[model samples]
Target: MSNINDKIRQIAKETEPELIHIRRELHQYPELGIDLPKTHEIISRELHKIPGLKIREHAAGGYGLIAELKGKKEHGKNVLLRADIDALPLEEKMESTYKSRHDGRMHACGHDGHATWLIGAAKILAQLTDEFGGCIRFAFQPGEEVGLGADTMIEEDKVLEDPKMDMAFAAHGWPSVESGKIGIVRRYAFGCVGDFKVRIIGKKGHASWPEQTIDPIAAANEIYQHIPAILTRTISGTEPKIMSVTYMQAGDVNVRNIIPQDCVFGGTMRAVKREVLEKMKTELEKEIKGICQVYGTSYQADIRIHGGSVKNAPELLNGVKKSVADVLGKENVYIIEEDNLGGENFAEYSCRVPAVYMFIGIKPEEKEAIPGLHSPEYQFDDTVLAGAAAAFANIAIHGCMGELKEN
Candidate 1:
């Protein structure tokens, strides 16, 4: 490894205590959505200690923070390193020292670690500004769970403008990948996220008198059953997609004798690309319309695709892989071929710029299987922070200096 890479690894490891402390503090007081006041304060307090960083506070409505670290040399290119600071609306079930104190709010998605890694990278990169070139934008985003933070920052605040980022990189915690390893996906890393709702409207009447009213429940059930069939038939079997009906509802349970005026069902839709989402939505709407027509009920359907797939720039993959290899090892790094339907908001940046989205492993040895990301029991050991920090810092430094190869 090069001297700078060695230095980065050493410093990142040495700062493990600091990283854990910050992560714990943030984890204890987890916040949700865009308005994260306490989360902002904690992050800002630590970032203020760094000298070269010029912090852009609350670029979005809430704590959509961006800290710019301009290098001393004018020889290289502008690069961006991003992280998220939002937590999910789930009560943490883990009985750890750093368990979330807030009710119904927790960093179950490992975003606390994500934020810590970026903060660690910022600290390390700030110390080595003379060793690099161009500028590094450390975007600490909020509302990543809602898939709106990056979009708002990029579109409204222009976080990537001014110097105009040449390359961008972001990483997420992957419990299935095991600590000390890194996973990379070429082209599309994950799929686009979309939410759809279907409402079946009908006249209300007593349940005993079926002929007196049009039943919306029957129409909703028919539409729900046809949804999965539509997906299976619309997209090819080779590139599978996901459509989960998270919720379905009708009249009050207290009054079972009365037929409800309306019934509603909604769920998430995911695909490797927007084309798949569009195809599924088109079929779903058609199915709903036909089913409602048959049941003599009117229907309303709303389907919106939130963002594009998290795509990696082919030009930057080699550079990123090399950076990870330097921090961990070539053996510890991998190029993942499969595409996941999981929604990641980092797509907001990658879809617009040359960005690489990575998944850092945190699977513990004690457990037979890793806890899912949004699970209440989700947690990662503190060991993975240093490696992630080292890799991120190295990527930012070398990438800015043009030491990293570009296709």
Candidate 2:
């Protein structure tokens, strides 16, 4: 075990420079959505450089790629390591040399680092095929920013079957923890995501008239105010839920003297549990309808479930914790007790197999204030990529060697 750890560390160290280079290159040419031809080209070229990896590509649903490394010792069963390859539709704010070259497109969520780490781990695992058994499937997914990556990959590519996965693993960079640290949680690592759109219909009239019109704006305001208060009374305080009204439109911007007949609004809701999330959705729809009724208005709604919460399998987590601690000392590893409301498409894979989604700390040492993920100013220290690479390699070997219980 110690010898394998030493080899993993050595290879990670040797590949650290290349990992950083690849991350920077990816950052420079950030692409949005699933049709990332250039990003696919770059990733495929790198994967081909590693010997004995069977590569598969998907272009219909998304720019998905899966590279399989057949083990020398074991042949049938497999393990999956996934990385998101899509970026956000925001412009880069950082003035770094590797800043996004594509206008209004950025890899602000650390996916650039995630993709590079998987590539580095794939190289190490591919080289030392004799060390462990079972196949290692490295999945580079697309459309994660808008949240269709994992489902599309699974449906279009059938990623979980054929060589069927025994266990799976993935990681993301986190700024809340200090750089180079690893955070693991046994349950509810990420929240379920739900997107909702509400349209309030009312009669339009002149601004001077008070009782002559049914104002949808008034109903929307009431719905907005009651949403938070109602959730506080209904949802348990222990469970963290976030409901945000991200977009709203009422009347024409140029005309202020008249009330528009329609008021349209949309937002996102997140909860740590699937049942709790569904409850939130039901409550929200009911509340909106009730408010519209009072205002003598009609309302329509569209509430769609994006992704479910991610829970790490307890038995697999124990083995993964030992592996991570073996690779990056126990002091650098942390067991997170609190659940994060952030949504991850990796939840799709975690729900399918005994999976571990780790958080790699990437906060810069010199900065007192760390930038949040998905923000235009978000950035992280590139040095954590090596440790991340080594830790993932450790999990791929150690996690598959042990017997895992199905979820």
Candidate 3:
């Protein structure tokens, strides 16, 4: 391993106590969406303690904070490190000293850990600026759940400007991999995401006369049944795509006897590429249109595109992977074979610059079932904090100083 990475690992270990304190505090008082007032305050307070960090508050026109640290040497390449600080709408289900105090907010997606390790990396890199020759911008953003935080930071706050970020990077906590390890994706790691709502319109009538009503429930049931085949039967077999109807309903529970005037159903669609996702969405509406026509009902389709996939720079993978392997042993760095359908706002950064997003494992070796992201029971492994911090710092060190060298 490189000597610079060794020092980063050491500093990260020494900074664990502070990392845990900040993580716990942020986890306890979780806030949601772009307007994270308390989250902003806690992150800003800890970042201000680090020397050489020029803190930029309200980077997203909300509570987003970006901390920039420059090297003592001549300017080289500019790198951006990002962490989403928003929480989910779920209530914390796990018991701990740092469980969320807020009733309806939770850090179920592990952004608290992301923020902590980023801060820890800042503290570590601040000490070793003499080894590198560029500026590192630590972007602590909000509203990742709504998929607007990264856009606001880039377009509104000009996060990619000022220094003109040459490369960007971030990591996600994934339970699919073992704890104390890391996972690197060679290509696209996340798929394009789109949400949709379909409202089946019909006429209401008494239960005694089935022919008198348009029967929206019947049309809705048919639409629900056709959802899975919308992508499988329509899109090409070569293209990886999926459509899942997460929710559907119609009529009041109090009056079950009368037929409802209309029924509504909604779900999400994903594809390996953005064009494929759009095709799936269009096919879905076409399928719904045909199904509703057969049932003698009109329908409304409301589809909202979230964002694009996370595309890792093909040329930069080996270099960043080597940097991560330097911090954590090479044996601990695993390659992810498949891309996930989950959405991420970080694609906003990947679209404009050379970017790579890795995954830090949080799966426990014990017998209990592992919780997935966005679940109320999801727990982030604190043991990965030091390694994650070291990995982030090492990426910056090697990327700016040793970028041209072969791994």
Candidate 4:
């Protein structure tokens, strides 16, 4: 165990420079959503550099790549490590030389780092095929920002098929924790996320005469105002849930004297529990219908309920605790007691196999705190790459050896 651990650390240290270079290169030419041709090319070129690995490209479209590394021992359980390769639609705000050249697109969520770390692990696992057993599947996924990547890959690419993964894992960079640390939480790590858009159709007329036409704008306002109260009353205070109206469109900019005929608004609904989420949806629909009825307006809603909360299977949870503690040191590993409100398509993958997703700390100094995920100012130190890659490599090696057992 100690010899393999030492080798893992050494390989991670040696790969730090290359990993940083790849991450910076990825940051400069950031791609958005599942339509990442250039990004796919770059990833394919790098993965091809490693020896003794079989690589497969997405036959349909988009930037989905799967690499399989076969160990010396056959018939061993296959494990998968996933990394999202899509960037956000935000423009880079940091003053780095590697800032995104493409405007309105940035790797603000540390996905670039995440992808690089997995590559580092791939290099290590490829070299240690003799010592380790089982197959390692590296899933470089796309469209994670919009929560469509995992489902598409699973359905179209048949990612979980072929070798049939026995276990899977992924990691995300967190700015709240101190640098060089990691966080592992049991059970629900992320909330269930769903999107909704409401379109209200009303009679358009002169703004001066409010009584002449039905006002969709008034109806939207009423519905928006009722959301907070309804959520508070329906879900318990201890439970975490949110319903925010992020995008609103009603009137035209050129015309101010007349009311617009259409009011379109959309937002997200997130909850830690499925029952609470269902209740919120039902109550919200009723409220919207009632408000539109009173205002004599017609409304239409498009709602999509995605994967639910990401729950770590009991076996994987305890095994990963030991693996992470072994690699990052017990003191640097902490157990998170609270649920993160963010959504992850990793939930979809977890439902099929035993899975665990942990966080890597990338926070800079305390006095000069960095921005959080999805924010324009968000970025992480490149040095954290070595530790993160080491942790992942350690898990893949030890988990396959059946060393990651419950105490």
Candidate 5:
């Protein structure tokens, strides 16, 4: 075990230059959503440089690459390490040499860093094939930002079809924690995401004639006012849940003298448990309809199940906690007791096998960390790359070694 850790550290040190270049290249050319053609091309080219990698591309949606490193002993477990390869639709705000060249799009979530780490791991694993057994699959996924990439990868049967993946692991770059630290939340890591679009229909009339019109704006206001109460009553305090109205569109702006005939509202709901989320949805719908009925108006709500909550496997998490502590030190690792409402595509892999989702610290030392992920100012410290790569390699080797019993 000591020898493996030392080797991982050495490999990370040796690959630092390449990793930097890969991240910068990815940073300069950012692609949005599932259509990552240029990004896929770069990944394909790099992985092909390795000796024994089997790669495949998805016919629809985006590209998914599978690189297999065959083992010598054949007694070890088959494991997988995945990294998402999509960028967000936000203009780059930093003044760095590797800023995004694409307009209105950037790799704000540190996915470029994630992809670089996985590639670095693959290179190391390929070089040290004699020490490990079974196979390690590298999944370069697409569309994580829009919340459909993992499902697309799964529907294509990319990971499940591979006989080598007995378990899987992945990580995300976290901006709140300082560089060289790691955060591991074992129980409930992230919340399920649900999107709702509501439409209210009412009769239009002159503003002066209040009795002649059933005002949709008034009904929407009522529905909005009742949301806080609904959340408080329907969702328990022990469970983490939040509902917010993000977008609203009403009648044309030019006609202030006339009441609008209809109004549209859209928002999201997040929770740690699926059943609880469903209950909240039902209650919200019923309440909205009832309120509309009272106001003599009709309403429609469209709720879409976007992403499921991230539930880390207990055993995998234990392994991760130990591995991260081993590399980053025990004091730097924090185990969060509660679930976060943020959605991650990594949850899709958790459904198939034992998986661990972790956050690698990228907070700057001087200024307060950039705003949370997806914000315009969000940026990760490149120095965290060494710790992140080492931690990921440690988790991969430990997971494939099958030393820890399932919890």
Candidate 6:
């Protein structure tokens, strides 16, 4: 086990140049959502260079790529290592040489680093295929920002097919943690995310005549005021949950004397448990409908429930904890009891197999604090790339070969 870890660390160091170039190239040319043509092209081109691998593209319009490294030993369980490839729709605010070339598009979530780590894992795994005895599938999925890419790839049977994945694992770059440190929580660390769009219908009339018509703006305000109460009442004490109203649109611009007939509201809810989430949804809908009825208005809620809480299987979580301790040392890994409210599409992989979603610390040294992800100013310390690559490679090798038992 020590020998394999040493070999992985050495291989990661040797592949440093390639990893840097891959990260820079991806950062410079950022694509958004499920339409990552250029991103897919670059990933496919690089993976095709590896020997004895079968590559397939399954994302809608060539946005996702899957590469399978066949095992030397026959009939072994399959495992998957995934990385998201899509960028955010934000203008690059940094002054780095590899800044986004595309206007209003950037890899603000550290996905470039994620892709680079997976690629590093692929290269190291290709070299150690003889030592590893099971199949490893590299999934470069798109549209993780909007939370639909993984679903699309799964529907297309990209990651879990034929040989079927026995387990899956992925990592995100954590700007909050210092470089050289890694954080692994036993799944369900992050909460589920669900988006909703509400439309309220009412009668428009002159503002001067207050009693002449039902006002949707008033109804929207009421709904917004009612959300906090809903959250406090419906969400149980067993799990953490949050509901927020983020967007509201109504009425005509620059029109002072008119009451708008329609109002639109959009928001999201986060919950740690599935049952709590279901309860929240049911209660929210009923409350909104009742409120609208009281105001003599018609209300329709178009709720699109997406990414669910990431629940790591116990076995996989233990294996990852061991792997992190082996690569980054024991003190660097910490178990977080409280679940993060942010949602990650990595949860989608849990549906197929026991999966682990971990974080690699990339906080910069000079800055007082690292910027939060999805912010235009967010950046990762490149020095963490080596550790990340080593961690991922070790997990892949040990996971596929089931070497943790030997340790």
Model 2 misses residue 116 by how many Å?
A: 0.5
Off by over 4 Å in 6: 58-61, 73-76, 404-407
Error of 6 at 314 (Å): 1.8
TM-score of every candidate: 0.95, 0.95, 0.96, 0.92, 0.95, 0.93
* Better TM-score candidate (3, 6): 3
Q: What's the CA error at residue 285 for candidate 6, in Å?
A: 1.3
Residues 293-365, candidate 2, lDDT per residue (tens digit)?
Answer: 7899999999988778888888787678778899899999988988888888888888888788888988876
Tens digits of per-residue lDDT, candidate 5, 1-407, equal 87777888888888888888998899888898778888888888898887777766652265666667776766788888889888899998888998899999998888888888888888777777777777777888887887767776677656755573777878888887777888877677778888899999999899999799999988898898898877788678777788899988887888788988889998988888888889878888988888899889998789876657778888766667887777667887878776678888778878777777887788877867477798777776778777787887777777677854465
Full-model lDDT for every candidate? 0.87, 0.86, 0.87, 0.84, 0.80, 0.82
Residue range 1-407, candidate 4, lDDT tens digits: 77877788888889989999999998888898888887888788889999988999862256789898888865467788999998999988888889999999999898889888988999888888987778888999988888768987788888888878888899899888778888877667788887889999999999999788788998999999999987888778887889999999998899998888979999999997777788888888888899999989999988767878887666777667777677778888888878777899898898898888898889865635778899998887798898888888888877777666554
lDDT of 6 by residue, 290-376 (tens): 889999999889876675788767676767778877877888777765567789877888866878888788876566687789999
Best by TM-score: 3
Assess candidate 2 and give its TM-score to the true structure.
Answer: 0.95
RMSD of each: 1.7, 1.9, 1.6, 2.2, 1.7, 2.2
Candidate scoring better on TM-score of 2 and 3: 3
* Residue-by-residue lDDT tens digits, candidate 1, 50-90: 88899988777778789999888868788889999899899
Worst 10 residues of 2 by lDDT: 398-407
* Model 5 misplacement above 4 A: 58-61
RMSD value for candidate 4: 2.2
